[model samples]
Target: MYSAKEAVSANNISEQFISQMTIRYLTSRKLVFPTKSILDEERRINSWLGIGACGSITYGRARIGKTVCMNYVAESIRNQYGSREMVIIWNVTDHPETERNFYASILMAMGYECPRYSTALILKERVLNELILRAHETPFKKAVMFIDEAWKLREKDFYWLMDLYNNLSGKDIQLSVFMYGTRELKDLKHSFKLQGKDQIVGRFMINESQFFGIQDPKELQFCMASVDKLHVCMTDYEILSDGLVDFYFPYADGKTFFDISNDFWEAFQSVRIQKRIAAEDIPMKYFIDSLVICLNMHGKLGNSPIAFPTRKELESCVALSGYGESDDEYTK
Candidate 1:
């Protein structure tokens, strides 16, 4: 019944005492650390659902973790509303911009297989019926679909979606389509507007939000604290009674990841400045990558113990993360 930190202290454990299995679990598992961007996006989605808005778009730069944020928000919505709503996450793939492919994608996302010989009309019917059935399970008669990689969708795809939206309304089920994609998604909306596709823009693009990376030291600290608080687990069992920070830096004189945010931020800033990259926000992918690099390089697994990472060490980790390398041209 001793807490993780207490157990570690009681046993006088050292970095070498941590098991390889625990390290593997920590490195391999998918961990969702909460962030301000995620919370804000969740709130905006909740507001849209509360008022029964038709749809909305969430766009951000590549590697900023828009997909992760949407997935988190989808789960959050399901937990909050329980059986009152049906949420589906559709990862839009590169396919022919045809109505048949569109309807087939929806069916596939909902865990149903589409017959190869099925016509677009047949697939559309199947999708509509399936959605109606799911909507009927909930008293609210609501179905929400998050379209990830939505920038791949074309104008014709939006018209097809509009048809589905209209059909669902006819059946008294409110369908909320939330699109999560890259900056191209915002440009897509503008493209639609210029073409006078007002209805399409009105339905899905009216209420939109842009996702961003860690904007400053404060935000970086928030994300670091979140990682510190996360429980390192294997399936349902906790490997340690204490959180990740405590387990990794148990002998750091009680200094937590929160206290090292400045160093982390400065390290990233130093890398950006040296690279002459103009992007101010630290992409979430690279941020997390840098963090994992830190943990693996300095934690128990690496057999190198430090109370916290030095600025130089952090800068090397950030550079190794390839934070500004891939998207420099776009950002510039």
Candidate 2:
């Protein structure tokens, strides 16, 4: 196994980058902030039973800390539980988003051969058996399943996850499964009872779920402080507490910490890349707007450029962004 540092330095934004970034992102004593409250509840879970399976919900909204909290939890679990423990993050956007593909990934991560078959149900059953076998046969059998962007998962995928837990229950296999995303999973829970709604209302940390909320002001400060040293350059972090954090607090009403932290890091890195600047002297809004221009033009758009946007391209990018025009701003 290569060191995570060496894995990150190598080309490509592989899972290693996600792992590296996750550690840096979550460990940031200052920048990652606190609304998650995830770390606390996770401690109460039983490693063997996965009693506190982080629900398969992302807590989608505007300012919620879904992704940020998951990042923290993933690192914490990795730190606490050794690397031999399985920690796989299945992104719905990047994969086939089907039950079969999902289970195949699980099989692959578990170090068990993925059966060459089309039926997910079969693979799911076989994998559960594998988990049991691995736990009982091995002395240090600790495995964790991490599902990110889980809200986009189809119903079949969700049911199988529940079934996997249900089958593994009462065994000493020691499974720690955490699902993170947005309101998408919460809504699905209305009809499904994997963890059961009673446990939630009754105050028991039932079903391995640790719901999060807006971070506290202290956590906010700590998070900002922590990330400042790890990444290139960042300054003057601001939280739009008034907007989504407050106004949209309900109905999975927050967008999680991804938007804010992503904004901060991208802008910070841009400052480092664009011009030779003193670490202390970062133009906040200039860097932010330029960063946004890159986001608008390069990211989700079709046939976008490979490199990040330039200072000159930003003006036209912004001007064309509102009009739903991509060509005028970032075209060849």
Candidate 3:
């Protein structure tokens, strides 16, 4: 039979163990690590907002973190400007390329029900009124829309978007648009230019940037450093004091993820070289996936101490990340 003090101590240990496991699970499932790409995209978008541009295009390959970057930017804008501005993210779907569908999509994105019986004119009015109401809530009377998967939109769609832009302008509300899509979006811009659709090009595609993943060893190190210092916060509490790296490898003598970044980068490059993939961009999805794999493989979970990952372990992690397999599919 345990004494009262001993029972309390055991209970405390059990609670700590449960909390650690919970954090590990949460981090594995969903963790947002800041990246340079997100910062650069934010800067570009802010510039567009500064100049009052109608819209701009941001194109990248699939899974390069464009959507995540846009998400971060939208949140940043909302936080920075607060109630002075409105930010909305609309994901363009592969629906029919018609004015009615376009307006309906916008209405849906704004969290409004789109009745199938409503005509295009009614949908247009509903969208405009919604925007105007939202914009009026803010002091600046400004609204920004981010169109994700924008390559799904055809040229005719832009004319409809332009009509909304014009109507919002007439209402004295400033609407700035930003389109995020895959490489096909750039192709669409080129096609429009070749077809001499200067109006659409000038309004939306004039300013553009290509998004990339982890580009070089330096960038990989930066990202790893971010992970090393990342503190998981829940309900205003910091769960992991030393981030995931230290949590997993508590006996590594203070080694962090940054210490193994070079090895990880080399391992990644080796895998790509062996697979004969020419692309150098390391998609964030696989990068984070690989890190999570490593954590699961070596995490001590407060039971025992573990060492940091070696180059061979990291190589296995990268290979298992499905980076090579995805690259093959992408190339084909």
Best by lDDT: 1
* Pairs of residues clashing in candidate 1: 4-242
| Residue 13 displacement (Å), model 2 | 22
lDDT of 1 by residue, 166-284 (tens): 99999899999999898789899999999999999999899999898778888898888877776543323445566776666667777777888999999988898888877788888
lDDT of candidate 3 over 1-332, digit per residue (tens): 33222433654544344334535654442455667787888998988887788889998877777888888888878887775237878998789888889889998888778897999999999888888987887677888999999989887899998888899999898999899998889889999999999999998899999988888898889988878766533322435344565446667887778889999999999898887776788888778878767766666643322577889988988898888776422452
Per-candidate Cα lDDT values, in order, are 0.81, 0.46, 0.78
Q: TM-score of every model?
A: 0.88, 0.46, 0.86
Better of 2 and 3 by TM-score: 3
Root-mean-square deviation of each candidate, in angstroms?
3.7, 14.8, 4.6
Evaluate model 1: give its TM-score.
0.88
In the range 1-332, model 2's lDDT, one tens digit per residue, is 33323343553434323433433432343444333355554453334224444333334432234565666666666656455344555555656667888788777766667768658888877788777765554354555666666656665665566666667765645555555665556555554455465533222123445354423334433443432333211122222122212211222233333334444444444443443332322222232233334443443231463333333444444333232121211211
Which stretches in model 1 have alpha-carbon errors above 4 Å? 1-30, 234-238, 303-307, 328-332
Steric clash pairs (candidate 3):
none
Pitting candidate 1 against candidate 3, the one with the higher TM-score is: 1
TM-score, predicted candidate 2 vs. hidden true structure: 0.46
The best-first sequence of candidates by lDDT reads: 1, 3, 2
Q: Sorted by TM-score, highest first, which candidate order results?
A: 1, 3, 2
Model 2 weakest 10-residue run by lDDT: 323-332
